[model samples]
Target: MLPALLRRLPRRHRASFFRRRMGAPGDLRRFLAIIMMIGCVFLLYMFWAQPTSPTSVPLQTFVPVVTSKDSNTHYAKIDFRWTWTCENKRCVRKESTETGVHVSLTTCSMLCGSSMLWPQPTGPTTLGSHSVSFDREQLTFETTATEPARSYIQYSFAMFNSNVANLIQLQKNEPSATPQRDFNKFIVKVFVEHSDIVKLTLSTDESYKLILRMEGENMIGTVTANNFFGARHGLETLSQLIWWDEFASGAGSLKIVKGASVQDAPKFAYRGLMIDTARNFLPVESLKRVLVGMAANKLNVFHWHVSDSQSFPLVLPSVPQLAKYGSYSPDMVYTASEVKDLVEYARLRGIRVVIEVDVPAHVGNGWTWGPAEGLGELVMCVNVQPWSLYCGEPPCGQINPDNPHVYDVLEKIYRDIIELTGESEIFHIGGDEVNLECWQQFRNRTNPYVDLFDVWGNFTVEALKRVTKANGGKRPKHVMIWSSNLTKRPYLTKFLNKTEVLIQAWGGSDWTETPELVSSGYNVIISHVDAWYLDCGYGRWRENGGAACDPYRPWQTVYMHRPWNGDPVYRKSVLGAEACLWTEQADHVSLDTRLWPRAAAFAERVWSDVGTKSIYKQEQLSIEDVYARIQMQRERMIKRGLKNEALWPQWCSQNPGMCL
Candidate 1:
């Protein structure tokens, strides 16, 4: 150290200093003193000039505190993305001064709060940067409506509070939060023009407009709709806009984007989800959960396909014998009172419960009691052998059109359905898979000259009349029938009334049935078997069973299908669509998994009525664009206790672009 210091010194100084160090003990002490003095000066210089240590913060780091004077200073007005400095894991929004990193409030919200929406609003919408936090317990509602519909609005407000679900924050302890700008009370109010509408039908106006803004220390929300259904939908959209912020103060701290407007309505009139509980019974609680899921997604029709060859679970008060002799067990039956309650439950959720008693074809076990009760051979070939030769699938059964008693029995079932649902505007007389051979073998023994197609077609005609009679001799304006051999070619127009029947095309999209039905002037609900069937591809439910519809339909297939495109008239004839969940491989156990997020995909399609090509080219949104949105939808469904299935890995969800 002394030599290095001497080398930097002037020539005369270096010589003088070295001369003093040359004398014995006294010289060494002088050298030591000189070294200590130089080292002290060097230490002091380093202390004054060394760099500052960075903070060990998790989310944000501390920046130089800008003084009060800086607030008055003028800076360049430029657009910059919102960034943050992590001061102990709190993502405090900051304005950057760097070249390109300077920025937006949306990004900061993405970190601390999420504003992602589902079934994306179909009309004009504006999202603002401001936010307000609310205490969930302090949420209240006010409205201008009469008794019938006001109750719906009140129930929906409570649902809105619960649906403001907490974002999943995976941590052991709560960290410090930036105290939010609080709203003293989150007051909501609604106005409905047609508050008398207690039932939601195809005619019900389900369009709504919502405006949210801050007022001094509180927030006021305004929802205007034509009916309670639309108002309820507005509330659902509002719920989507709010999320639980764990990083904010209070046990129930929730944040929402302030100063927003939305106008929304379904693009198609009948956005539906068909749950085939007949194949395998679903619990009432599970079905109610399904209703909640549908409400969240803005799906209107719940096509409850309650009967088939495998089981007769719905106990009709007119014919208790059917369920008595036919049900797998007594507890499995859906009682008349239960059906009434379910219908009411669905109605309150703004969903129409269209109970389907698929006649002539998907009727077997329930009809066996007919002959035992002295009705002549009601459904022949019940559980017939060499099943493929007689029916579409195993456990072969078909209602005997030859028996007058069969149609009489069907009339009672239809009457019960109409009574229970408290809905007679539309009926779903399911006419899916009809086995000709099942009836043909029985008919050959009686009268071989009868044409099978005419007989099948006639059954639908008679059933429609019976259901019409069931509705106090007034025909339902629309009757839904599943596309089958009878709905194809010459047979379609020959018997099925184009004015009254709606053919739900479940044939392959490439098959021309959807176009034919539309071209023939019959309205169609597009549930193309290849595209919209959710129950496909779980593998054979039985040994070498119904694999005809195998190869599972993923969410992508469900989202992009548009069978009635290219013509406005054709699109007009296209009523809407349904995602059918046949319970061959799904039941209460896997109900949520089989239908959800995928069904939600279908929900957006019918609601927005967007096409795959249009979304890709015109809108410039590929499948990747929808992945995150649907993921958020799935998360919301889970928070509401929906148990929705995830089609992506957890890692992929956290890191978005990397997965793509």
Candidate 2:
């Protein structure tokens, strides 16, 4: 009907008719006039009679837009802008600025509180407003009876430090002044709902959930965990999310990007790192630092290679003479108290201490333990004897299998170690590289009563039984051994129970032994030497003229390692992987450089998805993008007192994407 009426009337007449009928002119000019009048009323109401509705406006637009002072300037400037929303109609904006701020608890508290604007309700119909402020560095908020309180929770920086001291201790190298400020303080808000005894159990779901929303003045963040261990991990991740910007405000500040959320747990139960302290004695303090590094990466197992042919640095109370004779020096041995301290420290970081006593084959140093103990001639000297009489390797050794006293000594050693490192369910009985010559001598001594293979099989079986029997009754939850036993001597399986042992597959990359061990129903931890060994490339330890292992194992190689790439059925038997650092030439000076960044790569490989895209990949991220992230983490570690090797030139690290 309207179309017919418009068609019957002229264009000029149609406008007048519609205006008369609708009580307003339908022309664009008249319509615009009405809108202008409404806008004027709104502007007047917003400028004069501000409503009680509360709103927030970023301070960037306010005058005197107090820019952040240069970081090195020792003074802080804060600018705040707040909006008062009135009845969903008008909003009043207010600004405040504080310059030349000093660093003090009282000052910080005042600055935090002063950002808020208290709104006053003008009329009886207006809603009640809030008057919020902070005192004593604590945020205090109060709302009127008509308004529901919106709590502005302010957590003490000291409280945050205490909550994550285990992690903070990693940052011991950080400057003493405002150390917490090294990382963004607002990235994570940790809340513990219940105070339960936090024991580091082997539960995969030691529940933790983190949520981050990047769409505000401050990125709102929350971390919820069932236990303290999970909370520690969440905080580490929050730290990882933070990026330090040197130019952000002159000196430097940590910044967290807008949106991210991660609910993480170890996919495999035994993400680990093996540090060989026996080959070249590492200081107790250095080992503790390594544990801190491992915790930072969320790697839980510290596979301590405590003893080897080169040295027996672990001081056992039952066999005190071992350290006296076997250790490189008196100062190098780990005392009982120190061992306990290290174990406790690891436990607090959710790391389990697994001691590796590489036996029989690597027991050349055991001969020095003492002749009275009958360990003096445990194995023939590899270098001093006829090749056929000792072992395959140049430096060969083995505990005399024919001696009954050997088993007795083994039991004592195992019992003492188990007692000292409390709650260790897995003990590594190093059964790798037991040359045929050593067993042949045992066969010759026994005179056909037992063959060479039989001697080796018997020794391994007896060692497992002794270690297990010492730990209460049943076999230890797991006994880790090198892959050579399962691969080279398949006959040993006749006397072995697959469930009681964990095969550490450190066979060089070319060796295809991991799958067979896994298929045979033994759980495995892949430490594939060619790929994950950090001690490689420096040179083989005992080789003449320092034989080099060629190219060093870079972080990329460690990151590319996939422990369960073959035989899906056997994948379940694959417990996890570890990066083994044999400290043949390493000492305190080179320890951090040898392990870090590269070890960190292994940590990410074990913690994150196998197929996570790499920055170096084509059409993906630029090299600098990934390099910067890793470098940043490395710098954080260095600040925490870890001496890390530089990944690239300083210019490349400082300028992201510029290296490419």
lDDT computed for candidate 1: 0.77
**Which lDDT tens digits does candidate 1 get at residues 382-412?**
8989887877777888888878888888888
Tell me how far the alpha carbon of residue 274 in candidate 2 is from the true structure, in angstroms, after superposition: 0.6
- Flag regions of model 2 displaced more than 4 Å: 1-202, 212-221, 248-260, 373-376, 382-395, 442-444, 485-489, 540-548, 612-625, 658-660
Q: After superposition, how far is residue 380 of candidate 1 from its true place, in Å?
A: 0.8
Per-residue lDDT over 54-104 for candidate 2, one digit per residue giving the tens place of the 0 to 100 score = 224222221222123222212222342332222222122223234322221
lDDT of each: 0.77, 0.61
Model 2 lDDT vs. the true structure?
Answer: 0.61
RMSD of each: 15.7, 25.1
TM-score of 2: 0.68
